[model samples]
Target: MERIKAIGIDAGSTAIKVVGINEKGNIVFYKVEPTSFQMKPQLEKIIEELPKDVPIGATGYGGDLISNATITASEIRCHSKGAHLFLKGPGTVIDIGGQDSKVIVIDQEGEVIDFTMNDKCAAGTGRFLETTAWRLKTPVEEMARFAEKADREVQVSSVCAVFAESEVISMVAKGEPMEAVIKGLHRALAKRVASLAQSLNIIPPILLSGGVAQNPVIKSMLEEELKEKIIVPPYPQLMGALGAAIISMESKTKVTNR
Candidate 1:
């Protein structure tokens, strides 16, 4: 077994992710759990199970919860690094997290040169779909299915998640097709993130990460809205943690070389 050289934890609003990396910066092991109201105990237990001596890097909204991390980095930096690990060059990274959406522009050297984020509201995030899913009494995953199957979609005019839900209700009341409504909601969310991606002077090789990347509807809609092909890693949700682990390994290697 390759000895784990570093560990990274992403304590996000929707999920907590832990990843261990070998000296070659390969992910050797990983664990993911739905975040609970009390995260400290869950994080502590996960740490207790891993190699205690490995350097730990933490990122995400709840990153500060990990008091003993060797280093803590912003999600923009971590996501950019994680995407770069796969892209290996300049690109734009769009991360539609549970509660926020970030568009990061990475330089040729794989460093973030500019970025934009939509954290002020849920309209531009996975939570937007989640909220609409709840309002429609449909599973979030099933909502994507509904959208994909729709022949055509209605317009979701509101950019506010709450207002969008009300708009959805109004459309449903007006006899709009459920599938059309769902598809419209997804298109609206994708457009919001796409707008963020366009806020910066973006480059090629666009990548999508975070849990939302798994939604086929979102990926397709984003590609349509941005008019660009986007790459989604096999394990999109784990990128933040993987990036942190990569950073840990890189930092450790640098120190040893010095």
Candidate 2:
């Protein structure tokens, strides 16, 4: 069978991911960039990097803005499709991105059954981690490592992002270690996500997606809260893009057969 090439683009709040897949669904090329402006230039750059013959599909919050793309998909569908490909089970998906978090429930066939999203606030999303990292004088990438070293628990009682910052400051004033504070931040975020998952009656083998899934501490905290193993894809951030690409291939096959 001749391999059909397809491209998938996930234009997110903070970053854009572009992935190319062969007929066998293996990623042939992948790239990521900061979504500095609207996605036009970013899409152009992605198209330039991919093979010209490949068909392209777009998804994510900025998907509709990329008018030249062949097809656009909802971020929820993309994330669920991508996570299901990797996790392979009936479960819930919690995706914490730069500015939002979403909980999606998937059936045994990898279809999205239901979903909830928190796009209105920064409290339960990656923005919380970024804010905490800034205040702790640590890079966001190092947060998980720092959190793992926490020797004692530090409670973050505020649900508001602003109030949580103030609360973290008070904990620091009391000589709380940075590790403990970071751990608390992870736990707090996990608790909110777990609550969302619970609302849908969380099934086993929960899958975590988005950039935050790369953080080991958040994954560990989420697992602890859910009392089940959480699955993280190898390229968690690119799952949406991969899902769009897979969808594009399927669509093209149908058109050709018809």
Estimate the overall C-alpha local distance difference test score of candidate 1. Answer: 0.88
Minimum summed lDDT over a 10-residue window in model 1 is located at: 249-258
What alpha-carbon RMSD in Å does predicted model 1 have with respect to the real structure?
2.8
| Model 1, TM vs. native | 0.93
Tell me the tens digit of each residue's lDDT in model 1 across 1-258: 589988999999989999988888888898889999898998888777878778888899889888778788988889888899888999989999899889999988779999998857889998899888999999887988999989999999746988888989999999999999999998899988888888889888899999999999999988998899989998899999998887766664332210
State TM-scores per candidate: 0.93, 0.91
Find the candidate with the highest lDDT and give its number: 1
RMSD of each candidate?
A: 2.8, 3.1
Q: Write the per-residue lDDT of candidate 2 for residues 1-258, one digit (tens) a residue.
A: 235488899999889998888887777788888888756776766666666656667898788876657778898888887787877777788888888788888888779889888857788888888887888789989989988888976888638776787788888999998789888888898898778777776677788888999998889888888889988878888988998988887775432210
Q: List the lowest-lDDT window of 10 residues for candidate 2.
A: 249-258
Quickly count the clashes in candidate 2: 0
Candidate 2 residue-wise lDDT at 171? 88
